[model samples]
Target chain A: MSHPEQAPEGRRRPASPTRALAEPPTTRTPETTRWRICREVIIHRIDDEAVAYDPGAHEVLYLDADAFEVFKQVDGTRDDAAIFLELAQQHGETTDEVASRFAPVLAAMRRHGWIGRTHGADEVS
Target chain B: MSTASTIGGRDVGPALDGYNPARRASCPAAPGPESPTYYRIGAVTVCLHSADARFREPFHHLYQRHYIGGPTLSAVHIRVDRVIRARPLGRGFRICVDGEERFLLRKPQAVLPHVEWAINAAVAATLPRYHQLHAGVVARDGFALVLPAQPQCGKSTLTARLISRGWSYLSDEFALIDPDTLRLDPYPKALCIKEGSFEIVDAFCPTAGALPSYEKSWKGRVRLIDPQALRPHRTPWGVPVGMIAFPRYVARPAPALHPLSRARALFQLLDVCFTFGRYRAATLDVLGGVVERAACFQLESGEIDATCDVLEAAWRAHVPASGRPDPADLTRPEEPVRPGVEAA
Candidate 1:
């Protein structure tokens, strides 16, 4: 079947905390997973809608849907491969193409704290 | 840098005109035969004038180029330059509609596609002092449907469908909220139709105009259509927003309406707002008050009939079946965020 491919690194099923410890400490800090909008500010979590809170101005920025999804998949547990697979599945695209097309965007998102990944569950083994 | 006035307890300022030569050419401040375009959402008077008639072809088309879409209206106001078009009214703003009174904002030049952005940003810029929301408002049977979506989530598609089903198109891009009464100010302009969905709309309602495609967009080519000719009716001013629904155009077997949690609802409302940061405290307070009162839900559907039925039912159940809300206090929540990313 020509289904969307999983992120090249492979998909990690949601595992228990025990599996998390065996992996190397994840470097996916907040900064590594912020959603960038208009190439200006970085936002976190956008599963629903997104509002940006500016500390200096004591104000909030509203993000449209496109920016919302791009920011929602930044959890450290999900690798680039997983993110690509998920987006592909949602929009109907092949994973290989998505990965090739999304690498730079994901990297840019990482620099802004929009996505992150940790050592595999079997890294210690 | 003139003194300030008050409207519904909010301070006011003088009308500021743009300096761009192109803009000046389109909208000269010199008194012309054309009357000033003023919109009264409660008490706030948004006075806009443009020398160019091309910008006025379709009321909402201007919004397509700027923001997403929302509730909007086009009307004429007759007034002497001394009072209606005068400098800041020292303290009291003229009351043209209902109990609400708002300060005046006048822009002499026509700013295409960017008009909605300027209007919404201006309203949001005064946050904490006033409330503003980034949402689309459509109405049927005196009640309005508020659709707040992240980009490319078929917001414009659903809006176009609602118009076909006889709902008055309030605004397709964004809805501006008044801080005092928690009412929605009309930012009605154009509808932004993205690719993939563009074909869907063309099939659903071929009569709606789809401008030539725009290329290289992440969502593919988008067309801005003037729903005025296609719309069934004019959305009444101050149509009480009865239902707040999030539309997801998934090709599923059936359309379902899922209830949303207040926290999640609040989170989403924040996400869909136009300029939460710009409005600050007022935006938060108004939005919070609205979310507290309105019913929030997620709509999953591939079929328009199912979606419409579910939406209509939700509206009748929550809102009074007799008529819509007072025109000034139509409150809307934020659209759903994708995931992990909270709603604006």
Candidate 2:
């Protein structure tokens, strides 16, 4: 069995904010870990926002435009490192700022079991 | 109670929770002069049987407006009988619905509220189709405004003030939303006002003082107020939803009303919503459509008079001079919540 908490080689927690933008922190997510939205979730779109219902868990949550955007990015194609950089560029924020902002939302979705992660991005489909 | 008129079009059978459909011989009603009173409140019909006529007079006084002449097939049966099991001075009453015992009470004052509560349960059991909310609904000009109220939220007080000021009374307890029509039907049950507000209510409803009081457990002493006294001939009926306001009573000079996104509003509403007969998908659809068409708001309500003013203003802003049927009446929900948006 593999340990999920074990960080990959050389990806350690950065000491400062400036160093964070360059080497984001290893605590938030593993660099090789890619997330995929659980396929069983139901979504009802209302304008830019969406009310996502998890049938398996029987729970509902409101995903505002920003959260929805972050959700859309979790296509199992990109790791958290890539997503943070992309959202950072789009929102005009540093990678560290975007990562911190996106962390809680991802936590909530994972808590709802709406998304799952796979390491090394191997056979993600 | 008409078979054709049952809520959600579901037939009345064993669906009534805890209702024993055994022949009336099994659990006989208390032996006495039982007065069977049939009432139709919104889409549900209830037939209540009380042993003593004088004992149930207060109930008649409060629910006089919603009474119907004849009985129907789908009616839920409630039997409140004074049963003296052991003690004579503190006699007990066995309250039953369709031959199943619901509540056993000894206090004379507790009878009325418990009977009202048993009727409340029967109504929900009878109408398994609509999604019911613990809300106070009032209408103006034909459009309904829903007050999604939680306990101690002053919903009863606010609703009474609005109705007394000429707003049509829909209900003070249940907001019945038909899943098919996506419209709210009135369930204008009497306003169960806590003792704290008796003086204020008596100011507008003079008869409130004369009505007998019941010591409702946890709620303290309560008096049931007939909504008709608050607004005459404000007959209950179906109305299109215009806005849903979640009010929080706080000390303030004027109430503050803020817009809410449909997603957020619908989620909050579902938190307090009960699906009686039908289940989830329909609730999501019915409530979703309501949120999409209606303006959702969160209010910090102050004194009743000022709060009414703020609520009226909010409703008027969404409904134009054209009287809410115009295509423009379909007001869009506020923008999607930005990151870290604070709730008001």
Candidate 3:
């Protein structure tokens, strides 16, 4: 747009701790990838949908019902594989099917710094 | 050296004619003695400094309701001045905002639009309080429909069509969402009719042809039609947002509206929000609230009349069956009737 949207202002909120670790979440993804929601990510949920904001990264994201369901599962206690397995069992699908369906969503959340790997999830917002 | 006084029972700031030329307020780009004109645009105070009538006259004419004959008291300020230079290379105008040069225009005719752009820039950068989105906003019966800006969207054309069809004009350029109330505030600048849709809009507004047009690089020419010329009065308060329609211009003979997911609307709106960077988390919060109760749609804009028909239907669908506010209600968020007085 040619309008007056200025160059994004300098980041005021704390930077995501996961920044130093990976470029795209895929490079750092291994079998034992524990994920945790970023401490400051604020999500506003609509009917089966949501919009997520990571203040540090200055990203506003929309979550479909599937993505919202997937994001809610990232509570820092379990690895991505385990979460997918549990979700698969709950929905009566195979682990591979669930992984293929939700792997991209997890990757996107990680890519946008809405979720971080296990070690970096302990930082205070 | 500005003063506030009343004219016809209305408050006015120090207008150019009555103000001292030697006293400069904010903008410093003008080279000669300056005639600074001030206007109150909602919660914002805009002061345009220029000695030339070409720039001042149009602003005064279009923004007549908001004109002030005195300086502002507490409103947010955005000041712009034009510096005309006849250099060895070419003649151009340097558009300045708040004592800083923001844009350089090669043609004098382009000064007005750039001045408006300068104001838009200042609002986006300076005001971290309001959630500013680059979109066209219009309202009906106290509820508003936000037309988020996009490539070839033809939002202004649709905005003019809506106004001609009895919808209130909030703005053709930006939607200022008040952070406190989470309501859509009026930026209510002129409805800019691009050259391509002149014939389409002129059919509804015939007097538009007599108005002078400006040269725009991509759009060829644009006429900034005053909103008041089309509508009698504007609701000078914040209105609740009821819908978000992302319009796309299609060559088909008829217009269409498709159901859009709230998530997608929020995503698209976030893309068009101008002050999203400044407000950060608050921007998302406000937008989420805005789209929460609003019906979202993707508008395939074809003919103006057909497009308006689709929009009016969408607007009508959102309103409750009873106690609907009047579309012409000059003030909105209608006072709830008392327990005993509701049915009367």
Q: What is the DockQ of each candidate?
A: 0.04, 0.14, 0.18
- In terms of DockQ, the best-performing candidate is 3
TM-score of each: 0.48, 0.79, 0.76
Evaluate residue B285 in candidate 1 and report its C-alpha lDDT on the 0 to 100 scale: 58
Q: After superposition, how far is residue B307 of candidate 3 from its true place, in Å?
A: 1.5
Choose 1 or 2, whichever is better by lDDT: 2
Per-chain TM-score (chain B), model 3:
0.79
Q: Docking quality tier of candidate 3?
A: incorrect
Each candidate's lDDT (Cα)? 0.49, 0.69, 0.68
Top candidate (lDDT): 2
Model 1 interface CAPRI class: incorrect
Using TM-score, rank the candidates from best to worst. Answer: 2, 3, 1
**TM-score of predicted chain B versus true chain B for each candidate:** 0.59, 0.81, 0.79
Whole-structure CA lDDT of model 3: 0.68
lDDT of 3 by residue, A5-123 (tens): 33345322222233322334446576676788864777767666677776766656667666777878888777888899889988899999988877766776666566777755453
Docking quality of model 2: it rates as incorrect
Worst 10 residues of 1 chain B by lDDT: B91-100
Superposed on all Cα atoms, the candidates' RMSDs to the truth, in angstroms, are 16.8, 11.6, 11.6
Residue-level lDDT tens digits of model 2 in A1-125: 33342222111111222332343223455667788876566676666677666554445666767778788888887778888888998999999999888876665555445677865555432
